[model samples]
Target: MAPPLTPADLTPALLRGALEAERTERGGLLPHRLPAWARAQNTDGQLTMAESQPSGVRLAFRTRATVVELDTLPTKRAYVGVPPRPDGVYDLVVDGRLLAQGSVPGGHVVTVDMTKGTFAHTPGAPGTLRFDGLDGTVKDVEIWLPHNETTELVGLRADAPVEPLPDGGRPVWLHHGSSISHGSDAASPTAIWPALAASAAGVELLNLGFGGGALLDPFTARTLRDTPADLVSVKIGINLVNLDLMRLRAFGPAVHGFLDTIREGHPETPLLVVSPILCPIHERTPGPGAPDFSSLADGQLKFAALGDPAERAYGKLTLEVIREELARVVAQRAAGDPRLHLLDGRELYGAADYAELPLPDELHPDAAAHRRIGERFAERVFGPGGAFADR
Candidate 1:
């Protein structure tokens, strides 16, 4: 542990989006996105894990620091029989442009040694990330924490003054999706599709992308319902289909109920329902998405759909099926709810793009695909005549 940096040490204040608490521990603050009341409702590991990752959260401030230091306690995850995952990345942005990207080396790890059907916790020393030689110029800085890992803010120090920056009138875009949106294999936090699109569109983003967790749950809908946003979008289908979390019979109503809840809070706000991006392996198949340990045994891991394609007769929700269903559902709902819109997920990353930049794991997109999707999204939704044209 190191000396604490209090609010008095920094000028102005700290801006924490979607964060509700400044939990004190070891004389430092740990930002939590879930409000106390909401956290109370979600005691299950799934909800707690999803909500605490701070997928789109960042530390934004105006500063003149020639040198900067951030201390974070990142919780890294590892599987039992697979190669270790990469260290979480921290992206530094100034004036809306990525300045530098770095990854912390040491952190506590939560190991899921599934081979034994158990898990283990290993505590490690904290690692410090320092950035210097910045020409001593004053500027706005944003430190985007890893979206795929749980990070605790221990302290932030700078050579010069630092203060929180305002949103600058940018439209706030609230987006929710599964692992792809949660930045599974993104090169860095800001490089995630939604994050990149938000940066390109010059909008503030509140991302609720969760890993295997975007199940159209009421709590998630309520979170969106209560949050203020100029625009909202939910990328549906992949997680549902891949996890086989629900059958076709439950998905349509679940989708409707999810949207209905959000509409309760944002009645007239432009809402977009996006289908899953092209995942060839799951486009026509159902899954209890299994890991290909054959590859893991060789130091890599990949996912392969386990269910039979014939299962579609049993109402399996494949990506193709999901896309068609979502289109129809949104169209029917849009008859009187014109503010709602649907985007073919393939519009962002389709069969063509996949041919070039395939999902390395047969699931999550690689960094290049993320870039492609982000650019397409900015051009579509944030561009002229699109659902979020004003944005």
Candidate 2:
């Protein structure tokens, strides 16, 4: 029989012990060694390179406010490997405290300091981090790494009996969109529009948003088709324009095909197809120019440019066009499937909201916009007795 783990056997000290042993045997976090080609199977596959690959997915928790009671302690040590970014330093925080702030080493593990307390590992590896010796409940926890880099959570532990919040009985809400849905420039993970929308609507979210990574792809459609969900939504168009990935002739059919693939798995679930919100800059702008990484590399240029004016006007994605196409597609599908639903992405975040909280770039929404998008989504799609609401 296996020996029981003692208190000393479970401290952060044990984390170091494990690391040392792994080093001796020449093995470390499994995700750290994952090949670029394998991780590339994800939405952000294009960005994956042998030198700069994501360690793995990390699960984090956040509370609205800090709780005073400490009945559980964090026992796990999570780390991620990131390629060098324009910004040299990476930021690590626990319960909002700046625990570790330093420059990342190439292909190395960066550990964050944790509060000392006892914790137990649940069924999930490196289970949820719980706090001990506190009187109140903790609401929010955050961890931020450099942009354009990859990281992973490797360990977790709690001292007291810990039960993760049950998956809301409601059906999981599956969503796919561009940078806006990927939490670009949001202050925190919870501040992302999808996160906000899911929380407000009280639904389980499987966010497949990818920054500049939302180009319609067969693999993405296949992933959506394979995953189980109660409801599903796909926000399309803007990415096609921003990335100059496809043309008007291709865009319409791509949208249709994407939906068709999703229908493979969720034939009866309510599926909402959304178009982009208003963006004057990209609305009429067309681009065929390649991303000017050369100038950006030398700091000569600040951002990439869309070079083809003809393509911009003819192929450029506009909110109006997106709305028209979405309406047409939904109307056609509704003739055959009554369970499908259609929404104008603008209902969630629009030009008017942009006036109040302008998107930092021509592409992504700011934090306030995320909140606004969440609230509007709750009122619209997930409102009382709506698709996602309890019947």
Candidate 3:
């Protein structure tokens, strides 16, 4: 037998050998593959593409180490929807090499065994992990989870070697919105509208878009309060109308309450309130469901529809109504608070976009449309020497 191994002698080559040795001693590690529909939950309690569904690209990572740990924690738990198909396998890869992978089994937390190393799956769990006896930085780490399910990452920690990227010296753009803002039908996680917008604006992003789940909740506002951000925006209105969830009587108060919550923490932050963009189908239409029969069925059971077109158009709450209300609210609050700002969602994606982009499902925009939306947002929000622009 060769001499016993020691830390100083554990070079990259030796680390790889140690991994092999640990695997051999522990009866070897099995590969975990994520299902075709893997996705990642974002800060705003929304799900964007985590993995391709039809392509079935395995999310794998490779690293020369004894163990690996995966952790995802979102600030707001109540708003983070559960994953749709909770049961699926995930593959782990490090430094372009496959190490270990396994299924998550539909729970908030799960762990894969790599022997001799402690791994923890803490969704909404506190305390970061510490690494021991590992040399060199872990260059790459990837995770694969079911996309159709709602999974949001609050925190990610690794025990191997790694370097946290600097905040890039760019002002962080913190955004809060509905599904459309959450990335709705975008091609991939990086391609989501908010992510795309952030890239174009050359800034960091904290996307808090919850799908079908973007109601103006107090808890959501609270989450936004605790998060650190340079520029902040809240996209409101569309989800309320689409769900036909509330009446005018309640709508105004909800908006006030949500804004109040955000104001509590970000008293002087540059805050923007964005009303809904245009969707003719739902523009004048009140929804407890969409035009589709299946959606209607879902709405009927949930009491999501406001049967009367007039009510949908005026009485209940429409995009136009939301715009007017948001404007008033911001104006009233702005008198006392100068940091508050307002932007109509139409400024990003609107009626004209319909002529060219026509919402495929009358609810969500297509990938191309998402690009257009991002471009417009970059131009308007960031603009030439705007607040979000690189100064």
Query: Best candidate per TM-score, number?
Result: 1
Best by lDDT: 1
lDDT of 3 by residue, 1-391 (tens): 3222222211122111001111212232211112112212233312222111211122233344443443322121111121232233344444434445454333344332222233445453322222324334545543433222333222333333433222336776777777777666676544567766776777656666666656776656777787767788899988788777798878888888988888888787788888787777566656655334443333321113345677754567777777888898888988987777777888778878888987766778888988988888888778874435542
lDDT of each residue in 127-244, candidate 2, tens digit only: 2232333323643333332322443223333332222223336557777777677666565545567766776766666666666656777777877787777888888877776666
RMSD of each: 2.9, 10.8, 12.5
lDDT of 2: 0.52
Q: Which segments of model 3 are wrong by more than 4 Å? A: 1-161, 294-306, 312-314, 385-391
Worst 10 residues of 3 by lDDT: 14-23
Q: Which stretches of candidate 1 lie over 4 Å from their true place?
A: 1-13, 43-47
Model 2 stretches with alpha carbons more than 4 Å out: 1-149, 161-168, 288-309, 312-319, 385-391
For model 2, give the 10-residue run with minimal summed lDDT: 15-24
